[model samples]
Target: MRQATLDAMDEVKRSLDGIEAARARLASRPSSLGGRGLDGVFTRYLDHGSKQLTWLRGTLGSATALAGVASEVGDSGMELGILQMTGPRLQAAMFGTLLLATWVDFLQLADALLRDCPTCGSEKLFADLHRVQSRMTPTLADLASGDSERIEAAATAMPVLMGELTHEFDTIRREARSAMEVGGKVMVAAQVMELLALISTLNMSLPRPPPAASTTLGMGLVMSSGGVIAGSRLVVSAEWVEMMRRLVQAGVISLPAVSAAVRIHGGQVMMAQANQDLPEGVREALGDSPEVRGMKVTGKAGAGMAEAPRHHVMPKEHREWFERRGFKGDMDIDQFCVRLEQSHHEAIHGGANWKLGRTWPREWNQMIMQLLGKSGRETGRALTRNEILNIVAENMKLYDIPMKFTKGRRR
Candidate 1:
């Protein structure tokens, strides 16, 4: 009877494993590859972890074969018992992979929201690419030439570039914390954060040495798209804006980093989004909005807020699909984003320049004051960091980019 009990427990464990794997896949839906663009790319990466779990399940199947062989040897399935422990380890591996992929994907998706029109707050996605290119081109020279004078000149100018880089990393870190890791493991957050700091540390390396693998903590975040930040309140946060404005005088605080951080801060702007359940049929009339499903009628359909004709995006697959239909070579996503920023003129609210290219230094905390001063004179409202995030989310809604909730939210 005891032996039978153990066997039953093993079967239950196997069944439970299967359920967990399935749940993860359903929640993550991790691939938008069929037509969703980057959103799909990220989802597919998450799905890959699910596929790994399937392999683990298959590995466990071999346990039965070992059990039969042990039975033949009169060993009471001793080999199978040995194989049992492997399942739990594989389970851990699957969980780790899922967590990693989810965080990375969350960062990417959030950035998409920021870079896109509407969410960029009157800016384009690649607004800062030129700045990066300028720094990278010469810095690449520093990395190659090793001349002290040229390197020193590069170093003096680095804070501007470093600011952007720092802001980008901080944004990735901050958004990764809120959206991706919410209700998830704190240790996981710590690890990812350490990885980010490691990247930041990499920025100051040229004067002494190129960033070593150890310093990066193995993240290899590099010049890849992973370095981009999502739009966020941090960009326009009163604290940061005031700080950045003072940077011109201070001479060094990382304007680029500040810009990147602002973008990251903007990514926090997520709302329940309008849906069919919301007042007015605007959601439905928008033709399957990406931001909402449908709308609900609040009053007689002539309410005060309703008069503005509140429209929301449902599922933008069809619209975006048509937009990208004739694309051939790799899309010039950077220039496309620049145009997006220019789309908004005097109507630019909240006093942010809204040009991705126009950014402040990160370490220069005084820019916040300048920004607020400018806001007081222009927009009549000085925003806190959180307000900036809300506006960013609003902008994302306008752009029609796909924003997904974390995997746990699927249920």
Candidate 2:
């Protein structure tokens, strides 16, 4: 591995250690006067923090594995592929480290509030806080394996989880007012709102699988299985693709052999399809022709059917602003669209009240426009493709939008 990658890994590890120490110190704080109810809250907070640290450690392990593979690969092209694969894992580890540190600070704030005003730490409040902590625990314990599917699932669950936390905190704040003096109540409510902001940040920062990778994997499964298996059944995630490339580079597998096996498997699937009987719903869903099924699996509309609505990640309304900022050429703003399920599309654009400016899509577009305008004003030139992507990624992180950008002519 390159020294820079090694250095990054070391820094991440050190940061993790620092966070652990901070959490330990918080955990070791003297018990609150409010008895076991308050103590239980503190313990649960520490336990949840520990779980997050474990997940971060697992992410670092994955980055290390990719780095080892990158070091062994002689081809520059392969090296670049490894770098791309490893970059996000490291970024996620670092991001998680920062998030955990902030979480600890929030916990400390809560601890202090309870210590000064034990009456504020009502049994009901403690119960609500505990519920939020339980909800925040990692869904998968074996995240150290760096399983992309599990990680994506966990990330997908964040928005709902954080939203719940926000609601609970609001309730906690409202209830706290009745149990404390006016000054103490104001402090508690302010702290709770700050925590709510942190929850929003957490929702946006969690890593999600890119749409292109999922689409490619879905299509690959359909083609490989000769339409016998549903495309949605076996997605070849980006992590799996990277693992395969690493195996090939290490000489444990050959491309020709893999190709041959896929072809053979496809033939077998075709034979099975001929003799097997499918359920009525399955048969209806698959239709009578393999070709038509393949088209539908890949999100393509047949002659008489319409595809799902296409939502432009880079809003079409502000096309000219993006065009002026180097969003044309290979990275055309027009090509950045994703076909979303109808309800999802509606939700993004503000559902039935889309005309209002408060919806996610509207807010996201406004943020992007401001970014572009700022860049243009500062540099007096177009932003590079990578620069534009960085801006988009940051905005997505800020707004809790899933990071799904597709670049190509719409299907």
Candidate 3:
């Protein structure tokens, strides 16, 4: 088996050489060969096809062998499944490892493609930021429209928004693997489960930009909080999501700012789609988050709390009752809502306004279009509206009472 593995590995090497040669030969050839007037580069994807084929074969063989072992172990009645197998336990472990290993191999290749210029094989980042950006150089001006800018901004911000989650996952990988004993393993296991949820929530949180604006209008709330990586955009990066999962699970960041807790049920956005205008600093503090875009407007679902009463007191009835005497039955929930579900959501949010509010006023919803700007003025991060919202919402709780339904219903 070892020799076979080695032989397969060797074959891959030979194939890689052939691919390089094909590319080199194509370089000397003219544009007829699809070099597109370029040297040492293939004008088309076919140029590197042979090497890819080789890599795939070797990868498949190793992955298959490991996966089989994993399945057998999974069939066993073990306490826990892991890779250090002498028996069934080993099998399950191998399966999990193989999956991650396969993903890693792909990651390396994809990273190379993005980081190294495909045409010149140069390390000088020709495509890493956003693949969309590299393709849009039309050399012709006045041919573009506002739509193009909006599209570019969104596509560019996708990965940048996934920033914190990236670091969280890195920490998880390091710490989770190091926990070997029962207590340590248990801790890591629980954390892994929670982190997994955080990761999923983050993904769902920023899957796409709102339909209204070409730019990220809804994500204003997320960016203003500084969760945004400086040069990136709305697209969530895998690395960033993973990091956030790890951090929250491990208790690194208590009360992690996960995706807003709106559930989609029966074709309806369950929570109020909503907010009211705060001062400029408050707005800035909200960040360019897609979630809180147009904090001065109303909600999509017509259920925002900001449109409720503005008085510092609770619901009129509740307050009157309190002023006169106490209630007869249990009115904690109802009473609290009176304090929270008010005009501008301020009746509830007055003390907690610093947090990225989950709810908004009616009018602010329309102003969402002006949320996050369309550009990343830095060199390393991109600004996605959702990310900005998460940042702002998370930070806001500091000044308030941390009123999340979980985060004080900032759900």
Q: Estimate each model's TM-score.
A: 0.21, 0.39, 0.18
**All candidates: CA RMSD (Å):** 31.8, 24.5, 27.1
TM-score of candidate 1 against the unseen true structure? 0.21
lDDT of 1: 0.31
RMSD of 2: 24.5
Ranking of candidates on TM-score, top first: 2, 1, 3
lDDT tens readout by residue for model 1, 87-119: 232222222222223333333433333322121
Q: After superposition, how far is residue 110 of candidate 1 from its true place, in Å?
A: 5.7
Clashes of each: 64, 0, 84
Q: Mind giving the per-residue lDDT tens digits that candidate 2 earns over 1-411? A: 244565667877997898788778777777655543225535766787888887798778866876675565554434443444554465456445644654664565466556655556445545655665565445433223343333433332333343344444445544555555555666765665455445432223222224444333212333232233333343223333334334334322222222222222222111112112322222222233443222211112322225566566777777776777655643456445555676666555564555654454455566577786798679887776556656665655554444433332433
Clashing pairs in 2: none
Candidate 3: give its CA RMSD in angstroms.
27.1
Model 2 error, position 71 (Å): 3.2
The ten-residue window of minimal lDDT in model 2 covers 267-276
| Displacement of the residue 56 alpha carbon in candidate 2, Å | 2.1
What's model 2's lDDT at 204?
30
Off by over 4 Å in 3: 1-40, 43-53, 73-411
Q: What is the overall TM-score of model 3 with all chains considered together?
A: 0.18
1-411 per-residue lDDT for model 3 (tens digits): 222222323433454444445445434544423322332332233223333334334433443443343343322211011111111111112122222222222222323222222232222222221232222222111112112222222222222322322333334333433432223455545554344434332333333333453233323322323343212433333333344333223222111112211111001111122233422322333233443343332332333543433222122333333333332122111212222444335423333462544253411221221232222334235544223333323322432322221101211
